[model samples]
Target: MVPAPGPRTGARPRRRAGGRGRGRLADGHAAVLQERPCWGSLEDDALFALFRKTEPKVQEIAPGHDPLGDLGPRGQCRIQGLDDDRVQWQVEFAVHQLDGLRGQDDGRWPNEFLSPAMVPLGGGLNGMVSENRAWVALPPSCLGRPGEFDGPTVVDASVGNKDVELGGERGERDRTALARAVVRVANGTLRQLGCKDSLADPGKLPPVSRTTPTQMDALCGIKGLKAPDAERESLRRTRVTSGQGGPVRTCDLTHSGRPWSTSVRFMTVEDPQLAKIFSMAAMTGGPRIKGTKGYGTLTPSRAVYERTCRTGRAVFLVEQRQSDRGYTLPRELLPAYAESEAGRLGCGPVEMKMPAGS
Candidate 1:
């Protein structure tokens, strides 16, 4: 597919094969895609379908542009889990990018802007945002499990497939395991941008906050965080029988819908399973845990989507309650982000307002 031009042009677009060449189609895209050892595509057409599709009049923001600038109250975030017979693992990731341009030598343009991106290592689309159909629709094959899933989660990674020694501790084990996965993915994404680089030790990274089910059910007419259809029927039933005081609780779930959604695919070659991982998301959408009311989905506005597609900027996510949306920024990265030109625009401390008619 041919790429239309957007933003500034000092460096020629690099190929996925990793070299400075006139931006051309089918270069590294094939090799880079092949480099991903897991997940087979139905066909080449399927591989490139998402890459070539585009939205009408999409905003043409570049990768270096900051997505946080126009972020909504509850900055969105997501976690992913995958396990094959030989492995079990989880990683948390988000779809945000750094703000603004960079010198040819900056990490954002590492190797002197020769490669399309220093991090993510794929998708050399011309534009960075929604207009960048190629980057947004990156084939599932390009994303591989960064490490061995030898254990149910990294918390148990060193244990390497041992049975959970404790019977009732599975919930705690799952929570911690999911928490660390985000750190690993966050560090991986941070390698490209100099700003907000991950700490040498990933263990220190914080786990994203998850939403409770009751809290999720309370709201009415929120965006992506709608109650499952069955639950909605239950709520209707409660309201009908009990009147305003019905047993049904009222809550509002508001998601930015910016980053879209995330999927988890796990495989194990040792004893059992094998594969790899989409959706447009305001924030990185995460895993599905039982008993949890909210799945941490978001419905970001068009502005937020454009920002995320353009930059792929922020590497991590922070999920908070709709009332606490403005505080969604991860505390660890808060300083660097605040120092950024966009952060300085007073974007911080954004507030999430619940809808009326509960």
Candidate 2:
């Protein structure tokens, strides 16, 4: 059989040796088997599918090896959170010994007397809080662990000199004086942990207020106060119940010469709680009663709601009886009503009339 012949002159071949067969057709090339577009032309979803085909299901990098390093001399490392979302991690460093001085008392000689001797160089100190606690940042490398020094080191380090200058009156460093330095260290450490400056001064920072009237105009134009739905429900529930009672009246008028006086004779259904709720309402809404600042301790047997009508001269009482022994008004009702003028303006169920003469 005759082998298939190559394409005619000026016609490109169908397959290439190395390249993937996904390329775009050149303009006006209507030749056999139209060429597919290059992968770059594919949409994002197609690219993801291509990726999944070429990658392994579970390739491991540095598998079976420990990821963390040894903790330094202090056996401590800074702990930081992974993100603003509150994940925590611990980091560790290598441990090594300090290089100089054999004995603890080696540094005892006065600066003016003995020549300096070599001091042991040691690994830096590591400071840490509890395992899960958050850390602000790491201390400087020099301060982390002191290095060994040779013979009467001239003690001319500017770092040490600065520390001494800023030291407190007690001849030792005062923490308050080091506030700026501490902040610098903390900022550096936080940067290493991959946080933006915004996270550093979060809630404590003051809000940026509108400076121009135009900037605030949008907010100011929003109309109407938001009322809680619960408050509306409570107001609706405070309407006086039918067949329960009539409006209360009093005989002792301030027009006459008597201290404000009104009496409520509670029915068997009325209890201490109901009496208290109404008594509180009267005190808050009505004129101040005699001998009390609007507030009155209820003698449940005597009255439910009592208030001074004309200054301290006359008292009017709204008496009520609970529908059942267990049905006294809730204690919270008074405060609930007082919270809104709409609430306090309306009265609750009442169940009695003031007896004639009393």
lDDT agreement with native, every candidate: 0.21, 0.21
**Cα RMSDs, all models:** 21.0, 36.2
User: Which tens-of-lDDT digit does each residue in 167-255 have in candidate 1?
Assistant: 23553343333233323333333333323433232122122113233323322222232244433322221100011211111121224
Stretches off by above 4 angstroms in model 1 are 1-94, 97-168, 199-358
Report the Cα lDDT for candidate 1. Answer: 0.21
Q: Give residue 295's error in model 2 in angstroms.
A: 3.6
Q: Candidate 2 residues 1-358, lDDT tens each?
A: 0011222343532221113453323542212212211211212232222221121111011101122322111111111212222332212211122212332111221110111110111122121111111112233232333222211111110012111222134222222212222233334333433435311221111111111221111111212322133322211111111121111111111111211111111111121111222433334432332332233222222232332222111122323222222222222122222122112223222222222221
lDDT of 2 at 159: 17
Q: Which ten residues in a row have the lowest lDDT in candidate 2?
A: 112-121
State residue 325's C-alpha deviation in candidate 1, in Å: 30
